[model samples]
Target chain A: MIEARHLSKLYSRGVYALRDLNLTIAKGEFLFLTGPSGAGKSTLLRLLLREELPSEGEVTVAGRNLSVLSSQEVQAYRRSLGFVFQDFRLIPRMSVFQNVAFVMRVLGVPVPVQQRRTFQMLKWVGLQHRMNALPDELSGGEQQRIAIARALVNEPQLVLADEPTGNLDPDLSLEIMNLLREINARGTTVVVATHDRELIRRVGRRAVTLDHGRITEVG
Target chain B: MAALRYAVEEAVASLWRGRRSAVLSIGTIAVALFVLGAFLVLTVNLERLAADWSQAAELSVFLADEVGADQQRAIEEALATGPVVASRAFVSQSDALARFKQMFSDLAASADALDANPLPASYEVRLQPGVTGEAVEELASRLRQVPGVADVRYDRQWLDRLLAAVALIRRIGFALGALLTVAAGLTVGNVVRLALHARRDEIVIMQLVGAPTAYVRGPFIVEGVLQGGLGALVALLALGVAFWATQAPYLVPLAAALNMTAVAFLPFITAIYLMLGGMLVGCLGGILATRSESR
Candidate 1:
């Protein structure tokens, strides 16, 4: 579950990355957050992730107070969410297995469990064959798959993606979205932010649209 | 403990994953630590040597050849009553001759070549505890003015000069230690920074996922400690080699000159402290550099 109430984020030089936004994502729901460039989609997700706190608001995600949790507690809260990035922020020097196993490693899962879980997740993402391959050795789509495997390794309650298919072709984008949908079907809440109208129309999930720092539409 | 172990594994694996970067960083740490260790070895030994010289020191004053057995007894009586003299030993001409011959075997034949009693009789005087440098000098002068005395040689001057040099070296060693410590810290910290930079996107993602700052920072600290530990190991190995490599060139003859009962390498205490200090520099550097970089 995620909720933001009348949140406003302002920066120096009168920049409001987001303004007066109110939204709630229910448990186990799959939704797309949509907007054009500079439309505050990333800012809203950042607030939800507690990476950047709202200048004035209350945000609650996964039953934790995002606005009031200490930095440490915020990090704990982050561990509950699986996150995908537009650029597939995998450590290039690390093996595909190492990249995916990172979250569990930090959580200090036992080696057998880590190997089992990472191996299984890579298989689910259709990347088991590239487990030993480095991120650079994989294609853009495969790299994104590794990132997705990393996100899901901990079995987080919610998954957030800021443009999950930004770098993929239409076919690859559809494939990645289907993977996300499959994850959603398994009872993990999914929220993706994207500017791709064609992809959004193709999937036809609940969509929240933003315009000039405010939530303008939700369907 | 499991958390720390995981942190270490993550750190080491992450660092080793970037092989060239890890080697370069660790090499920088090792080089700095080696220099520090070498200086530490010299400083510790110099301290011990100074103490050895002080403990063994005494002033030997030779008596004139014409002085009778009675005057010699009188001078002994005078030195016996002096408060500044803690202890005294009278070496007769025969005893002095025997000791001189024994000390320098190459010069033994040269001693027998002399027709007269070339090695004179002498009194070896040890000064009382708390006798100042000035006290030793003035006492030696007083002894030289005695009726049976020919010339007095305290060798306190030599002691004073050696102590001064030791003090200077100790000062220089401390300064060098500070400089080297800073250099080591910076080198390790910068290495951590480089590792973090190379993994910048990974860090960003970690932060994004609600990974706690500590979790995000844990691996880097682990890497730092590993670098420091390896540096210490390298330094210790180098010290072992240095000890053996110089055994024939420096230790054997020096040990012979001192008439040491047993020769030894660098003290174990010095080695332990060197390794600990080097490792500390590394761990501290990692924490500091990552803190700044992550922020």
Candidate 2:
């Protein structure tokens, strides 16, 4: 589903965010990119998302090279992918239902379908009762669940999460991981970037560890 | 169409969120269009008055007292052959005196006290419907050169001056309207910029979620258009009220001076165009503000 050949991202003078990295993940595979600070985890995710272009190499996802896509093509490519953030990043003014339905609206889905999908997705996240509540009113765990529902509302084939449980308690983190695992079990590709090695050890998935902008180990 | 609907909903919501700036922008647009509308009203009515008088224009050729009958006949022949002359009536000296006494009864004694009847015999020559002012001037000059003609006066002279004044007013209106419209556009852009800043987080999130650039910027554009459209409405209402309020006190007397039966407001089509123009200016502002945000 994804391939990175000699992927190197250079920042300003003498600063390399990712150095000569080559990686691959098969379709429907759940993977973890574990690294310490400045280990190029988020930078790699950004490159995969086509949010940034690699300085020296190309990253391809689902068969299209990310480097050559037009502005409009980039938008369409991104619509097929889902992204979750540590901050939840939900629009504060929107209710849980609106936040989840926003993706469908952006895709120009029919209003009836949007409502139905949003309701179903909220139920799946176990936030159906809190659908009318604003993001500020929800706990960190519930907010992250709503964020997950939003990410999945458009039925994207791949979901990339950056520190998805960085703000939650241990039990809440485990719950969110379970939700991600269930999604993976349903045949969606998942890549999570985090510094939490304990969670990585428990998940027992393919883990790629990086240090100083280079891959150090793959277990 | 779906995008347009979303834009409108988002625009309305955005305007509601930034009601203060919206009101300010709308007020600015209203003032700009109102000034332009006022001049438009003036020019429209003044042109109407000029047309009315032009249809009734006449030239009066006053005859010399000692002119021979043959000289008078020659002048009459010239009037008869001229293409610009629709009709002509010869007013004898006695008839002219009689008209003076009838029109000014209180001053009849003053005319009686004058020696040798100061009024001269004249021919009142009505012009053709669509004769040019230059044609009337040429005809008047030709009449003055007639052997017995003392002087020639064309009523269209004053009408020509009035039309020139109307043109000047129209140009001034256009210039002022253009300047105000620019200012209004800038105000709209500023207001939309403020809204963009307030919703920067939302915008970033939208972009991250792969919202198209149009979807992200659509609401701001719609917000500008609403401000302009609402401003145009307010201007039209104010212009109507001002026209109605000035009818008895100001416009009535002005119409009387111009010999016009009534003063007219702006035409329905012109008002519609003004509304559309306001919206267009707003759209421009929106476009200008978001030109840099394209990703």
Candidate 3:
């Protein structure tokens, strides 16, 4: 579960990334955050992930007050949330297995458990055979799958994805969106940020729309 | 076991991610350390030589031939009894003649034709350490007044010159050491900066994941250590090359006179410290660079 109250993010004078944003996301819910570019979508995501501090108000994810958490504790909070990036941000030099194992390694998970879980997650994504392949060797769709696999490997309670389908075609985008829905069904709350209005209308999930750094509409 | 695997995995991946930068940085560090190691070997061993020569300083006082054997004993007793003298030993006239012959055989051949023992009996006196130069000179003058004492002499000039040379070498070594350390730091810093630039996106992603500062910093620190260790190994190679290249000329009598043989290279402990120091500088630079980018 994630909650934000009176949240405001002012990047600079007269440049508010988010303002007076109050929101509550229940457990196991799949939601899309959409608007045109520069809609403060990314800022909201960053704020909720504790990647950036809010200029005002509070944020709680999994019942932990992120505003009060120290930097160390903030890291613990983030570990409970899986974040997927648009760029697929896999270190191009590393193999698929290493990229997925990075989160567990950072959190100091045991080797046996890390390996077992990573392999299992890779298999779930149907890419267990590509564990040794580097990102460059994989296509766009395959790389996206690897990214999703990594996001879910830690079994996070909340999954935050920023433009997960921005670089994919309409067909690939639907496939990625479906995968996110399946992940959400498996007891993880999913928040996706995107500008694909057609896909959002078609999927018909809860949509939070932003414009010029303000939450302008909700559907 | 998991942490080890993580460290290894991270280290290898990080190295591979920044292979060109890592190799170049380590090479530069190694070259600098090699110069320092070679210079250190010479500095330490030269200090030992100077000390050896300082300890070897002793006075040779020749006694008058007319003095009777019992009077020689009296003179020896008197010299031994003096407050300024730490210890004194007498060389019999016959033994003195034999030693002189052994030292300079050609000179001894001519002296042997003198019919009598040309070398006089002598007292070799060693003063206690910390004895003032003026005090030793005055002490020698006082000893010359002793009965049966023919003459007294001490090599104060020789001892002072040796001490001065050793001091000069030590000062130079210290300055060079400090300079090399600063250079090594700068080298590592530059390398780390370049590495941070290359991995800017990766670091941003890690920060986004809310990896602890330690978690974000660990692999870079380990990378620094790897760079340092490899640098040290290269420096060792450089030291070996320099040592071997200069060994033939430095082993001659001239080299001995200048104390080259006695001046050894870097000690085992110092080598380890250099490697660690290199790693520390690399890590410090890395931390500073990433601190700016991680945000």
Candidate 4:
């Protein structure tokens, strides 16, 4: 459901984040982007999310060109995908329920439907008991679970997680990884970027490795 | 409907979350609107006073003592046909003396000391509506040329000064009101900007989640409107209290002299205009705050 052709992102002073990278991921595929710091893994994911423009390439996701979409069209296009930040990025002042329900609210869903789906998603993520709890009150693993529920509440076709387990312990990381796997198994395309090779080895997923702005390995 | 509810809920929540800043914004708006309201009240009353003075204006053409009845009749006939005269009344010496006595009731002994009637028989000429300045002067000049007329007099200098004062007040009031309006709008804009800065992370998350621009902007705009509206309400209350405290001893007599109703001097329309002005200022502020996409 994603395609990139000769994608190259350049920073100031002649530094390249991604250099002439061509990549594709089929629908409902679970893909891991493994790389060290400054290896362009995050840059590639940002390109897919259309959060940044490439210096010398084009990206198409689900048949829509990211570079050409108008601002309004970009927003509408982004609604079809979900993003999970490494820090979990939950609104600090809101409850877990509010954080998850926020996506549906943005979609203009009715309050009753929002309540129902938010509760159901929280239950699926084992956060139903802590729905009314604030983000600061939750453990790192629990917060990540809330973030996952938020990403999945809208039932988006694709999910992009950038270092989703970066702040958690080894056990919590595995738990979050397994949750992402289950989400992928449910017919959602999942792309995760992480430098954690042991976690990648444990999950046994198809992996693409980037080094020095180039794809070094794929398996 | 669902979107509107959410927007309102978010707006209210935002206000509650940032109550300190909200209070500061509201206070600033209130002070600005209070200045505007004071200017409006003063201008309206000044205008009423000017109109009252203008309506009472009349030209008095004094007849010469040696002129005969025939000459006097001819002058009165000319006055009746004059274009500027809306109406004219012939006041004889006795009638003029009676009016003077009534005006200075405490001077009865002084008035009785006079051997003969000192007042002149005159034509009290009421000009048509809107006759003023050079128009009145021209009409007075024409009256002086008529037979049996000794002098033509009207309180033109005082009227000119009053009208000039009114015009000056209106001009200054307009300028100050405009300045305060702009300041109020900018204050609201600054407040919204600060609120946006406070919620920067939340905004980023919202953008990442594909929240439309309108969805993010709606609540801020609504918050601005609430601030402006509450500020205007406070200003109106301040104005009302000011008017009440000063009315009986000050504005009542002043308004009475101007032939106006003291309580109605500030019309209902002024209040409506003030509220709408506040709302418009808020909307402008909201637009300015959200104009940039840098965030």
Q: Runs in model 4 with CA error above 4 Å? A: B81-83, B98-117, B257-265, B292-295
Give the TM-score of candidate 4 (chain A): 0.98
Q: Residues A1-219, candidate 1, lDDT per residue (tens digit)?
A: 888888899987899989888888999999999989999999888887777878988888866878888877877888888889899988776799988888887676788999999999999999899899988988999998888989898998999899989999999999999999999999999999999989999998999999989988898
> In candidate 1, what are the lDDT values of residues B136-220, reduced to their tens digit?
8887787777788998887667768867887787677677767867787888898889888877887887776666556778778
Question: Which pairs of residues collide in model 4?
Answer: none
lDDT of 4 by residue, A57-175 (tens): 89899999899999888898889888898999999999999999998998799889999999999999888999999999999999999999999999999999999999999999999
Q: Give the range where candidate 2 chain B is weakest over 10 consecutive residues by summed lDDT.
A: B286-295
For B207-248, candidate 2 gives per-residue lDDT tens digits of 777888779889889988998999999999999999999999
Clashing pairs in 2: none
lDDT of 1 at B279: 77
Model 2 chain A, poorest ten-residue lDDT window?
Answer: A195-204
Candidate number of the best DockQ: 4
For candidate 1, the per-residue lDDT at A143 reads 90
The local lDDT score (0 to 100) that residue B153 gets in candidate 4 is 90
Off by over 4 Å in 2: B66-73, B80-83, B106-118, B293-295
Q: Count the backbone clashes (under 3 Å) in each candidate.
A: 1, 0, 6, 0
Candidate 2, residue B96: CA error in Å?
1.2
Per-residue alpha-carbon lDDT of model 3 for B1-295, expressed as tens digits?
A: 4445555566667777778877877877786677667667766666666566545557778888898878777666666744467787878799898998899988976887887887788888876655556777787787688777888889865767766776787677667765765666566656666766777676666666666676676666666667767777888877867777776676455566775444355778987887776777566655655565555
Query: What is chain B's TM-score across the candidates, in the order shown?
Result: 0.77, 0.90, 0.74, 0.88
